[model samples]
Target chain A: MADEVKLFRTWSSPFALRIVWALKLKGIEFETIFEDLANKSSLLLQNNPVHKKVPVLVHNGKSVCESFVILEYIDETWTNGLPLLPKDPYERAEARFWAKFSDEKLWLSARGILFGVETEQAEARLQAIQNLQYLEEQLKGRKFFAGETIGFLDLAVGWMANLLSVLEEITGYVLIEEVKFPLLWKWMQDFSDVPVINESWPSRDKLVIKFQTMRDSYLAGKI
Target chain B: MADEVKLFRTWSSPFALRIVWALKLKGIEFETIFEDLANKSSLLLQNNPVHKKVPVLVHNGKSVCESFVILEYIDETWTNGLPLLPKDPYERAEARFWAKFSDEKLWLSARGILFGVETEQAEARLQAIQNLQYLEEQLKGRKFFAGETIGFLDLAVGWMANLLSVLEEITGYVLIEEVKFPLLWKWMQDFSDVPVINESWPSRDKLVIKFQTMRDSYLAGKI
Candidate 1:
């Protein structure tokens, strides 16, 4: 009823959940429309014609696509909420660099280990470890990538909290070890402890089931 | 002297030039240290250890890497000049979307045509045209991507002004035509017509010489 916020998303999509966490953190209530990734809804297609992907936040009829962009929009619109970005321009740029880094370098490496062939998986595992180490260094002196608060960068990379464990279980590749990534490991725990995120996040069981199916399909050459 | 801004860049780099234009548009005077790509300066390596690439803006001893991030940093830091981003949240998101689109989709396609093998070049040419058409539709009635004034999106896609011609010269693949992309053609001219851009831009003959060498190297398997 308030601002007619509608989120076009898929339940299992970590990208879409980023928007969900942002919206909840802002204390803005929105109706969620779950989408089938295989057959995207016309509304999603019409709203986000370019990517045809989920997590299109349609607020008062206008659509904002891309999870990070959507998060920025939500932060700007609801100025009263806990701020997602820093007030300082340089700090904001630093936050942005890390968020882009998380997406550009981190996610792909994790995906490779999860779905790649044997040799590829081994290479990807090393890449993932190196990326995690960088994240560990970034998180060393701070509670979150954005400092003591849960901010934009944390939410952007928060999927690893649950997904990493599920991936480890499925692939038997223990990437994010506590000893190796103490800061990142603590950051993961701190990120999941957020009430809204914990509430909105898909259960580990849900992710495990879906990922297992995906892995089986990939191994069988069906996907 | 004022906050000590230094830019690490190369003369021929489009990415580095983006920072140059941003700094110019803001009227923020800075010294440029040209770096040879083959033998990158230790300062460049130290500043942007992740990418080890050009166009790192160091202000007051702090480094901000990535062209778009630097642009945003400049816009936010200096509020006196023509604002690069729109005031409204939605408009800003739209601008960001297109900027990302131009980088993710358009750049790859242009690279494909410029340096990719024959088969890859043909496929990439089609992709580039389709992307340009989408951009043309976006520029339908507006004078600029950010309405009447040149902004981030314009700067993001400004390479077509100089580089596209050189690419066409080298590959003999003409992707942007006046007949098909009247709006974009006009936009390109308007972008290049900017006093700051025109004044600071590298000569077309210079780009031709550079790209000719690059194309030859690619064909000879020397790259």
Candidate 2:
């Protein structure tokens, strides 16, 4: 294809995985440039000077950085592809609200385990689960965030479900449970069962080892 | 017009101004519903149950909450207008980067006055100025956030500039000075000078009094 699209990514990064999932769902063929986190490429640095982070998508040599923004770009560019954003403006805004909230609250909660060392830090992890009660509240009756279809908000909130168990195992605390957060528990199943998402996802066995390894290295001060 | 739009806003809110500016730029006619913060309507609560915040854009009986999300909705629905998002995906991503950063760091710094007492708040104000240094560094050779034309990022970041001066005036610490943050200061002036923005902006004098009054009320435990 003359319309060459290239993606730069580092494995074991949920932020990077967001873009990867979108690309796979869209079924867009492109070159994948797996970046060395330790020794970052000049192209990655040049393309994304502000963040200089992974999952920079380059289409025809023009780059789109930031996973959420990149997701929006890919959705906008490929008209005939699977629509990532909702068609209704209000629904789109609601999806974005959850997206922003995901960045604001959920992901940060997951990061708690990565840096949790103190008693307060460990307690903070529990408090984060309490903070995520809002998700259960939001999911009360909606089949999906945008109603009966997986959309951007679903993808975003789904990241929490994928990471929570691994995060709990690493941090030595059980947070989300089917017995407690039934709606969110069901959300985990609903999201993971999406065929496209299922195909695109790294195996849980694979992620558990990867995340656990990274967490161990980080905790041991070897990272 | 059967396809109607309504904006519920507070007089002293930067978030509200964003919607006002967007509608004015698009030449869209809509009913302005100014809500008294002291006496919020049931409709406002019903429309935005999550945050219950103003600056909600009600279009054709559908409600869109959050200013940035509203901006996106506005852009998508009304196409025969000056665009807020850059046409190019890369540029749009860059715009989003700055926009998100503005919301995170800049707003955190600007809203310092809301938290602590005087001296602490002054540094909180200073932190906002320091936050702009990174922005200044980025704008070293550029005119606007995404290059020549004012785009989405410009609107978000410019909100910081408007509020910075207001916060400074109320807190007795000037944040933006011509000599220190020249680029940001000049850019703010350039931004407000534009006919659409200039016409739509609330008067500075009015905001200064309103901010000071609000601050005093908070300190007096009247809030």
Which candidate number has the best DockQ?
1
lDDT of 2 by residue, A1-223 (tens): 4789888987666777777778777888888888887899998898776578888889888878777888888888886767889887666777788788778666776676666677756776776776678677778887766567766777666677677887776667777888888888888888888887767666778788877887777788943
Q: Fraction of reference contacts reproduced per prediction?
A: 0.94, 0.91
Candidate 1 lDDT, A167-219, residue by residue in tens: 99999999877888899888888888889879987877989999988888887
Write down the RMSD of all candidates, one decimal each. 1.9, 5.0
Instruction: State, as a TM-score between 0 and 1, how close model 1 is to the true structure.
Output: 0.96
Cα lDDT tens digits, model 2, B1-223, are 5779999998878888888888888889999988888989988998776678898888888898888899888888887878999787666777777787778777887767555486877778667777788788767776766567666877777676576777766666677788887877778887878887778767889988887776777778943
Q: Name the runs in model 1 displaced over 4 angstroms.
A: none
List, for all models, the DockQ compared with the true complex. Answer: 0.89, 0.59
Using lDDT, give the best candidate's number: 1
Docking class of 1: high
The A-chain TM-scores of all the candidates are: 0.96, 0.87
Reference-based TM-score of each model: 0.96, 0.77
